[model samples]
Target chain A: MAETVDAGFLVRWLVAVAEAVDREADRLTELDSAIGDADHGANLKRGFASVTETLAKEPPASPGAVLVTAGRQLVSTVGGASGPLYGTLLRRAGKSLGEDGEVTRERLAEALDAGVAAVSQLGGARPGDKTMLDALVPGVEGLRSSYEAARAAAEEGALATVPLRARKGRASYLGGRSVGHQDPGATSSALLLAALADTARTEEA
Target chain B: MSPATGGAAAPVGIVLVSHSAAVAAAVADLARGLAGGGDLAPVLPAGGTPDGDLGTSSELIRRAAKAVDRGAGVALLVDLGSAVLTVKALLAEGDELPEGSRLVDAPFVEGAVAALVTASAGGDLDAVVAAASEAYAYRKE
Candidate 1:
């Protein structure tokens, strides 16, 4: 299987994720409205749309540059928490990718680890806090194991949100009430991880 | 388009209002992630927490408001009921509050990005906030 991920593919994947968010934005917002501010899907959609436009207009020279640019754009353009967090994730990962527009499997792993660390630093949320970290951390870890493992872990993380107490973010305000609902951030994080796994798998074939 | 056409050239910052500290922090991280590095200064104020209770929300809002010290202004995005009330209380109680800071209805992610985009693209704070509010039904990917 190929190990390197080219910048073009990375941009395409980001665009795909953005497109997915746009298409499913209403559902994402509806889910968020239940316990959040009712804007997860909507917010991501707008950010990604801009990301798509920016990437299309002037594609970055390197994978890290692409992600960093996207992250900066999201930070400057996106107003909410997810914007920065996701932006941070991409930016951190991008930073770890180096100047080369392509990433080896090892580089990918390193960049993802950097992203997870950045996310942890920015959010201060650990696993079981019912946040995106739950899904993202496991998803990144799973990449070292196998794509199937990563997919399953991400799915499990998303499902696990239903039983969590939502120790962080908007859903946590509900207190015990947040127990039964899946965290929108975590769910979305899972989707992002799943997309990465999908991309890796498809590219390998 | 030029900044003139987009909106005013207002220096903008982010406001993160969630129900919990972890969520606020996490959301803040999300915003930071989107910003790539520290390109966008994000202000995270979780409305409440399981342990911290909701009483401190007003203080958080006040602190977040202070972070948006630029001449342009700060945009506030809230998550839930008490959180909203707490932010509103802070803004109302402040006699010397900055003219640039105000709460507007914008979704968690969309609003922040819209604000950032508008501001970066040369839109004013108000225009950015207006654009951020479009997070509710923003077009898909």
Candidate 2:
């Protein structure tokens, strides 16, 4: 089994993400309605739609190019803070991949770490703040193990946000009311990592 | 472009980023009106999502920043949350903007007006950004 990812695998990963987000759009929106503007699902749906369209329009030659193009589309299409946060994630990760034809798992993990750092820097949100960083930080950390482990870690991290008070984004405006609700951003981030892990597993199989 | 060669061609530009399209355009209009509607600094509005919804678009900001950038540079003022994130992401994409372009963290309306007024007076990019940042200290009391 190959331990490396390629552009084709990345494309499939994005497709999986789009499909997962599409399926869970309503759930994500429901979560956001509690603490956010109730647009997380719709925003990501639109952004990922644009990404798929861009991918179909101009197929990227490299794995880095694929992620970069997807990031640009998300930044342009998605509304709210999630747009830039997700966009920066993929863009920074793509840049870290450099011009390599094949991406090693270690390289991908390193790139994801950089991407997670960029998200924290851009949003000023930390793990306990009940933002996407809650999931993303642990996801990146788990990448050091295996894709399945990363996926599970991301899910756990996202679930951990349920007990946290919001300290960032629109949710923060709710103060104490933000507790006891799962963060929509963290949930969506978990989905993203899940999609990546699924893709990796499928490719390896 | 350097501020040392200031002229009509090298005036500092201002960009207003907001979640609402109407808000951004209205603020730009208000700033322009305050500047007497003459050859004041170029004020561009990069507001809303690409679909005209309520959200910030980095692509739109990048376009507006490029359009308004003459030679001096651009000063960007954002409204809350994702607007700032979008701008930061755009900047982090490496060498996307011309030299000296910056994002000013201040009150959106007041900062836009102040930055525009300063730019209209031939202020450089740093000066325009400073004016916008200084608006944070302003109190209505």
Q: Chain A: TM-score in each candidate?
A: 0.93, 0.98
The interface root mean square deviation of candidate 2 comes to 1.2
Deviation of model 1 at B24, angstroms = 19
Q: Second chain of candidate 1: TM-score?
A: 0.73
Model 1, A1-205: lDDT tens per residue?
8667788878877887786777778877887888787878866887788898999999988888888778766644443567667777887788778799677766776788898887776666789998888888888787777766777887788788888887777687889888888788887887777777777777878
Number of the top-ranking candidate, with TM-score as the measure: 2
Recovery fraction of native interface contacts for candidate 1? 0.00
List where candidate 1 sits over 4 angstroms from the true fold.
B1-141
lDDT for every model? Answer: 0.70, 0.88
Candidate number with greatest lDDT: 2
Model 2 over residues A136-176: C-alpha lDDT tens digits?
99998998888888899999999999989999899999999
TM-score of each: 0.61, 0.94
**Each candidate's DockQ:** 0.04, 0.79
Report the C-alpha lDDT of model 2 over B1-116, residue by residue, as the tens digit: 46655455578988999999999999999998887755798899988877787888777888899899887878889889888888887777767765667888879999999999
Q: Enumerate residue pairs that collide in model 2.
A: none
